[model samples]
Target: MDMIVQSLRLGEIEIPEEKLIYMERPVLGFEDYKQFCLIEIDEFKPFLWLQSTEKPAVAFLVVNPKIFVSDYKIEINSKEIAELDIENVNSVETYVVVTLSDKIENMTINLQGPILINTENQRGKQLVLVNSDYEVNYKFMTHTVEEETEVNREVPVEV
Candidate 1:
């Protein structure tokens, strides 16, 4: 029999698949982290925070590329894409790492470094875009949210 559950609670609240957010592997400085979940702290706001499930000591704030950097673009390596078993680019969801500052105006999002993953397949990869004209910590925050979603950050690109 095939049994399906809508949402699972990591601590207390139940997180549904529709609310689950995925992240890729972290860069050299954050190599240890692999799995993460995006939790929505607000309903009106577009900003979401990433929390590491693999190590439990890692987390980052992320945002939609269209919100802050108007001309931000990222192209990942084919090998890394293959490793994640990504059959097509459409299967992947992209999110940039963010840094929150004391003042809301000082926020930034890491456009250069991005987290890529296949939400359906449950695999992910943190790739560095060689030609990306962005930073490791791109902050773009005008306000903050208290809740977000979480999902597996890494998935095998190939069998």
Candidate 2:
């Protein structure tokens, strides 16, 4: 059965009951909200909203880390897999929360911790990587400032 949910990001929308995810370990700083739904809109191709059903005003921008880092991978311990009731690795989906910067060029994603969900059971958990070089604030968009070198500087020549 489909249920109507009010989202601040998308306004009132109807979501299927199967699409509802129950978080075993809710997102950091949002422990009170265990029920959430992932909303994807075409306009925001690379980003999706993890809207909290409990609180319509609360939503998170999340994306698959692989979208930015094609080689992104994580090892899930047996404990985590069992907790999520993940039968097979293929049933798991990973999403990282995106932190938007005032300047779009500076936007970054949290790779150190990722939200893993089991599609079969609709259960999710956020895992914090303990033995990894993944940065908490990994910048996906590469931006650099041009340097002013002496050789390139304009020199005034005597007439």
Candidate 3:
């Protein structure tokens, strides 16, 4: 089934019902809205829009920590994931909210709180890692764009 969603950023769009994610436990400070959809924009490849279907204006920039921090790992309590009805661990995917700053390098991601979703059932919850050493504001973009682009340009030439 296709549901029409009105988004302030993306405008009105139709998406499959399966794409809708119902929050088992709503996002922090966003309890009123439990339904959201992860929208991926081509220009913003690594980043995604965690947009609230209930409220068009509510959206957050999110990304997988593994993209920048390859060794990013977190331990979640079994009870915390019970609501997601996880029959398989492989169905679970994690995303962290990104905070943008005036400068690109100063951008940060909330590693202490990660939003975990079960792809099978389309249910999700935001977990606060109480005992973890992760910070809420961890610097995400450390390298300059010029440095990465230059390296990419040299890669194909060398190959």
Candidate 4:
């Protein structure tokens, strides 16, 4: 199952065919792409690239919502669950699209729209959560290391 893909980050690389995830419904803004591969870079653990197979330049940075918000949850309709052929809830894998910025602290995660995948069937769908408390610009990192360190060093002056 050796397949080569022209990736924006890795140039041309070989990937396993089975690793490709089929998107039944296009991701919100990326309706043109129907197939994508989840590439994991060791340097960026808990973060991965959802690279489109149809278009090399199209890619997205995604992460598990639970990493930052432990209570993150998604409720999908039965029709969607049936479309993915998902039987057990454990078979589904969820991820939120992340928008990175020059300033790490300003990075945001799209919680309202989550990409749900049926690992067993290799099928995926980007679902919009209805009436969710989550936001599109949920600050992923509220404080930088320097800021945290500076706060820790602060000492109250004598009253």
lDDT top scorer: 2
Q: How many clashes (backbone N, Cα, C below 3 Å) per candidate?
A: 29, 0, 0, 0
Cα-based lDDT for every prediction = 0.57, 0.81, 0.80, 0.80
Q: In candidate 3, what are the lDDT values of residues 1-159, reduced to their tens digit?
A: 998888999999887999999998888999999999999999997789999999999888998776665556766666765788887776778888999999988899998888888889999999887887877988867733333333221101000
Lowest summed lDDT across 10 adjacent residues in model 3 is found at 150-159
Give the winner by lDDT: 2 or 3: 2
Candidate 1 residue-pair clash tally: 29
Worst 10 residues of 1 by lDDT: 1-10
lDDT of 1 by residue, 72-111 (tens): 5566567777666777766776677767678768867766
lDDT of 2: 0.81
Stretches of model 3 off by over 4 angstroms after superposition? 143-159
Candidate 2 colliding pairs: none
Off by over 4 Å in 1: 1-13, 16-24, 136-159
Error at 86, model 4, angstroms: 0.4
Question: What's the lDDT of the predicted structure labeled candidate 1?
Answer: 0.57
Residue 88 lDDT in candidate 3: 75
Using TM-score as the yardstick, the better of models 1 and 2 is 2
Overlapping backbone residue pairs in candidate 2 total 0
